[model samples]
Target: MRIAILGATSQIAKDLILSFAAHSQHDLVLYARRPEVVSQWMNNIGLVDRYLVADFTAFSPAEHFDALLNFVGVGNPAQAAEMGASIFDVTLKYDDMALGYLHQHPDCRYIFLSSGAAYGASFDEPVNETTQASIAINNLQPQDWYGVAKLHAECRHRALAPLPIVDLRVFNYFSHTQDMEARFLITDIVRAIRDKTALKTSSDYIVRDYLHPADFYQLVRVLLAAPATNTALDCYSLAPIDKATLLTVMQDKFGLLYEIQHSGVAVNATGRKPNYFSKNKYPKEFGYYPSFSSINGICNEIEKYFMQDNLY
Candidate 1:
């Protein structure tokens, strides 16, 4: 299969590319503003010749692809917060470019890496594909920009694109590529354990579900094979982990020397916490089941850090 990826600089995109590279039969066309940046990663996979250093808006593919994966835009929440409202403009610009291409090449399958934010900061309940998104346009905020733009892109793709495309809404995902300094829960734990520093956190009552690389591999493979239809699926593990439980595991299993103190309030930075982890309906729909449970996935990442020095 011939696959093309936009935003090749993104760490997640690189992970996906590496996963695809495991299958030598699959050819990849990687696009980025700076091709030199992804050169090392491509070389690592022995696919250096498969990259194209070009802007997404200007570059049109010379060869047809069986699938096109759009991983563009500022995905980091901290970065999105800095971008503020312009996030919408930047997101739609690239999305429209891809949509226009789909109009020209309706046969190609398009897969967008969306986020749980696209569900509009729902704290009320666990969101699934069937859940209705809740975005408050009148009371827009910087935090909401990323989710709003993602939701907008999903809507636009479904309504405007001539062909059916897949939008995978990622709730929480962790891998070796995860930025250690980032304020994510897993990274915080990793840092605390490594540094032997007392981990300071907000309330540990919040619930989060994480996606493993193995699960991601299965998901992409299933999506590539399944006939496209305008649909969105949540990317989550079969198991959900609570913040407190994760901390407990770290303390007991890894001998983490950290003092866990809560601020006594559960402040929803993005929105209210989902009552439950997003449902894993992708398996039922596409026959792609996740391999790692929350504990196993976390342990695997930590083990990589300790043994291989591939610290996240």
Candidate 2:
């Protein structure tokens, strides 16, 4: 298959690119704002001259691609907050670009990298197929912009029902390629372990499902092979993990030291999510079942990270 990957520099996109190159015979054309960086990264990974790398500006409708995956958006909460209202523009711009190509090539399947944030701020429980998006339209916060942007894109895709597009609402994702300095709980734990310092965190009883790269790659492959459909699918693992369990596992496995502060840590830039995963089993219909649970996936990736850096 000829696949076009936008925002190819993203961590998830890079992981998928590696997986595709190593595991499949797909011809991948990478589109990024910084094409040189993508090329350099490919070189660093010993993937030199294996795929075509082009700038987003170079994307043309005339190009032939069986699948186009849009990973073009803010990668982290900090980036989302920093991007502000521009998040909507960034999402719309690339989505419109993809839509234009879809209009010309209806056979091409589009897989958008959406977020669990699209389900909105009320995640008291896991989201399911019946769950509706909740938004405070009258009182919009900076935290709400990213999710709203993604939801807006999904709405547009649904409206174009005839087009073959699928939005994957990813709740949590982690890999060895993740930015260690990023302000995520897992990244914080990684940093602490690497530096051999105590991690200060809030005692928020949050639940998350971290989808491993391998499972995510399998999901994408399944989607690409499935019949054309215009709908969204929630990404999930075999099981989700809670804050206490995650900390305990870290301590037991990696000698992690941590303290819970009564004052609590600052809220994430994308707002708080107590139950940030989904209960939707829709992906099973497409023959994609995760092989790793949240804790196990986290441990697997962290071990890879340590091995890569010789820190373990």
Candidate 3:
């Protein structure tokens, strides 16, 4: 399969490239805002021949690809806060560029890396494709811009795009390549385990799901091959993970220590309700189930950071 990946420097995009490159039959064309960085990374991986260094707006593929994955966006909350309304404009601009490209090549399957934020500020229950998204009418803040932008892009594509497209509303994802300095739950746990430090949290009553990086690409491959009909699928692993059990396992297996400063708080840090898991048809529709459970996935990541001598 021939594919073109936009925002190729993204962590997820890089993981997807490494995953796809393992299969000799899959050919890839990569584009990033920084082509030199992408070229260096791809060259290190020994698959630099299929890459082109160009910005999203200026990039025009020489030939049609079987699929195009758009992984572009301002993901950092701090950056989103700093960028303000420009976040929405930048996001929609890239979406429009990709959609226009898809318009010219109607046969190309389009996969967008949307966020669980598209569900809006509510997380009272497990979000499915059927869940209605909310908008903050009275309290629109800088942090809300990212989610709002994603919601708008999803709406725009579903209503207007002429080609086959699937917006994978991703929740939590963790891997070895994740920045250690990032204050994510998984990274915090990994770093604590590595340094033998105690991890304290306000509460562990909240529940969520985590996807293995490999499984993410697998879902994309399956959906890329499937008939895309303007659909939004909640991207999650099969296993539902809660904070208490996850910490328990880490403590038991790796002897990591954690303390819950408070309990009885069901609400997450987002101030909205928490979704234990997401409902999707990846298993039934695509026969795709993630091989790694939440614990197994974390252990795999831990092993990569601490135990494994050779980089994968």
Best candidate per lDDT, number? 2
Per the 3 Å backbone cut-off, how many clashing residue pairs does candidate 1 have? 1
Best first by TM-score, ranked: 2, 1, 3
TM-score of 2: 0.99
Clashing pairs in model 1, backbone N/Cα/C closer than 3 A? 123-272
Q: Is candidate 1 or candidate 3 better by TM-score?
A: 1
How much lDDT does candidate 2 score?
0.93
Q: How many clashes (backbone atoms < 3 Å, residues ≥3 apart in a chain or on different chains) does model 3 have?
A: 0
Q: Every model's Cα RMSD, please?
A: 2.7, 0.8, 3.2
Candidate number achieving the greatest TM-score relative to the actual structure = 2
Report the C-alpha lDDT of model 2 over 276-312, residue by residue, as the tens digit.
9999999999999999999999999999999997997
Candidate 2 clashes between residue pairs 3 or more apart in a chain or in different chains:
none
Per-residue lDDT of 135 in model 3: 78
Which tens-of-lDDT digit does each residue in 1-312 have in candidate 1?
Answer: 877788888777887877776755687778876777777767765777764545454557456778888888764555666677887777787777677677788888888888888878455667765677777879876677778888888888778545868898887778866577765667777888888787777754667888887788789888888877777788878788877788888889887766656564232335556453686475557878788888788888788767766432
- Rank by lDDT, highest first: 2, 1, 3
Candidate 2 runs further than 4 Å off: none
TM-score of each: 0.90, 0.99, 0.88
Q: Write the per-residue lDDT of candidate 3 for residues 13-43, one digit (tens) a residue.
A: 8888878877546777787888788889878
lDDT scores in order: 0.74, 0.93, 0.74
